[model samples]
Target: MSQPDSVTFADIEVAAKRLAGIAHHTPVITSRTINQHTGSQVFFKCKNFQRTGSFKFRGAYNALAQLRLEQQQTGAIAYSSGNHAQAVALAGQLLNIPTTIVMPEDAPTVKQAATRGYGAEVILYNRSETNREELAQTLAQQRNLTIIPPYDHPHIIAAQGTAAKELIKEVGELDLLLVCCGGGGLLSGSAIASQTLSPKCKVIGVEPERADDATRSFHSKILYSVNNPDTIADGARTPSLGKITFPLVLDYVDNMVTVSEEAIIRTMFFLWQRLKIVVEPTGVLAAAALLEGVVKAPQAKIGVVISGGNVDLKGLGHKIMNYEL
Candidate 1:
């Protein structure tokens, strides 16, 4: 099937309307310590507090909500590492649709359990030995399930934009907006919204240094792929940007940068210790960039997206205890 045209700002607006009362308009947080550290006034769109503890719920719910009656009755299928799996599962449960998620065997146990708890069937595969998308597609065909892609679909992209839409709406204009990039859904979607809502704000995409496909793609002007990256930021281990998201990122995003795994870990600890908020490593990507001085604009009003908080506490504790600096 042909991909839909790039998601437009108008599409995001419609998605915001559709998601109203369903997705949480998560709070925007600020920290004097963060402001002092970065020398910039910063606002954090804390989607960690969102239902399912991630912004993925916005896209998942919007996509599931728009499904036709026949599709809804038949059910939906998706592939994810963790966050999207839980998001799809919970959205399906809320909408009374059966959901099946294909995830890596190494995905966080807490996330897997949460997905199953939401009444979705779980299929696990070895990340190195199997292709998740192919498996999900085969299952979707066999089960007559509509594929609710994590980030590649226009509806998903539009839905993901609602986070930025809500942020800009609540915080007013910003000089810059930083988003964590996985498959580019959130980054591309937020870029679109930022362009429309806060046109003067430069939208930047941040990624783990190990999983820098989006950053490479942004600068190289060509799509880049990676084998699974060995990074603690599991959500950003995507191979590459999708065709739908690539162009959107190229057109609307102002810049892309990467931060070290150490920086990600440090920022996660900082947010937990200073702000009293739990942010997973992936959720701290944008903040990592700013705090590490990978991307800086002193004295400017900046917005950063804290993407999720569905961390495996035990695993996080182990990392924290073992990690140095």
Candidate 2:
């Protein structure tokens, strides 16, 4: 069985301290409309407003800030679909560490542009032709750069846990904590915090139906793999949970669920229309589970993390305009 030796609440506390001035203490919001609709007192921890427009900033800054002086001088490299790329790029720029990001050629143009705008060199590769991680490792060896993975690292998970810590602290306790899962960094990290802080709270991870490998793995207690899922929730398209995250998830998470693509798109539009916030498809997975009645918890005090606001408006414009939500 995998364990959370890689992360702990204390580690999250340290990470929170490291991110105090650097990362945004994003708002914990509530909606009477949503509460009325779902019959639950929902408290949303809006990471959409976080620096770099996602919770990835916390992990990125924490890991980069802790890099050895030698590693910092030599710089860092990373592979990300989108959010993590911008995060590392911006964090590297802030920390005066040079960064290089390997991104999919079909990644959101907005994300690609933001990554480059942060002063990181961007390298695009065809997903079908090349393995991103291998390319990143090769490049890292060539450049003597540290690899800052999207997930699968201790610092990353611990830092990601800070969001849950913040939510629990501000909101007191939760009956349920719904988190979106990708590589399981946020899900496992949040579950660890929830289990420790609000022991009674049921921590559930949500994924797109098209990319339900994590949910499948959770049920079977075996690692499962998916190759480049074609879901709108791009962040949740990771092949499978990471080595560290898989065990942490198995240990901490209470349940796992999947939401249909219609549910995902509908819930995202609902947030935008009702909450007046821009959340990407991946960001709405957890909310989709809750709002679409996939994980019904009537009258429960639900804590939901609205993960990111980085919508690829340029590329997904048509889909957004005509999404009959």
TM-score of candidate 2 to 2 decimals: 0.97
Point out the worst 10-residue segment of candidate 1 by lDDT. Answer: 1-10
Model 2 alpha-carbon miss at residue 45, Å = 0.6
Candidate 2 — which residues are off by over 4 angstroms? 1-5, 320-325
Candidate 2 structure lDDT: 0.93
Q: Write the per-residue lDDT of candidate 2 for residues 49-165, one digit (tens) a residue.
A: 998899999999999999999999999999998999999999999999999999999999899999999999999999989899999999999999999999899999999999999
TM-score of each: 0.97, 0.97
Instruction: List runs of model 1 lying over 4 Å from the truth.
Output: 1-4, 319-322
Give me the overall lDDT of model 1.
0.93
Cα-based lDDT for every prediction: 0.93, 0.93
